[model samples]
Target: MRVFTVAEAKAMIPEVRERADVIIRLRANLAELSLTLNTTGESPAGGGVAEMKALEAHLGEAIGWFNGHGIEVKGIAPLLIDFPAVLDGEDVRLCWLEGDERLAWYHRTELGFAGRRRLA
Candidate 1:
């Protein structure tokens, strides 16, 4: 696991937000495709097998980008991500979720997002 310092995590906030935006858009597109596919058995957006696969592929690639960077992806529905980090000698995760403008939250690894607190 790559353990990041707060500075390190914060440094990547812009890139993270950009990627999150792309993932968010792709997810929306995929969901729309799924809804259409399930509703009338066809997609008005020309979403045949190829179109669906392309959307899936793009989504996979976007999410995989984080994995490749050693960041943990906790959720896709709201795009929660965590950077493994140790603060004050204790292990924790520096967390970011979709719609957050900055990297300013964290929680102990065991507590998850429910235990999130504002970064001091």
Candidate 2:
């Protein structure tokens, strides 16, 4: 696994945030399209198979970008990302959640998000 320094991780925040926003928008569109298709088999507000396919395609592209950048995309609902990093001589994951505006948290590898701690 690639380990990033804290500075390196923070420097990536802006780009990561932008990509995450794009994914969030795509996810919202997909959800809406799915709801409409499942219940009534068609969307009244411009959603359809083509639109869904486009959104999914963009989503896949975004995910691939993240993978290429070495950022771990953790969840979809509340989009989560973690950067493999070592801090204070210990292994940690720099965590970023959907609503976070900055890279200010981290967690030990074994603890998952339940162990998230603020960066100092």
TM-score, every prediction:
0.96, 0.91
Candidate 2, 75: how far from true, in Å? 0.6
Name the regions of candidate 2 deviating beyond 4 angstroms.
Answer: 45-47
Cα RMSD of all models vs. native, in order, equals: 0.9, 1.6
Q: Scored by Cα lDDT, where does model 1 land?
A: 0.94
Tens digits of lDDT, candidate 2, 22-117: 899989988988888889888776657877788899999988888898999999789999999998889899999999999999999889999999
lDDT of each: 0.94, 0.90
| Model 2 score (lDDT) | 0.90
Model 1, span 27-84: residue lDDT tens: 9999988888878788886657678899999999999999999899999999999999
Q: Model 1 TM-score?
A: 0.96
**Pairs of colliding residues, candidate 2:** none
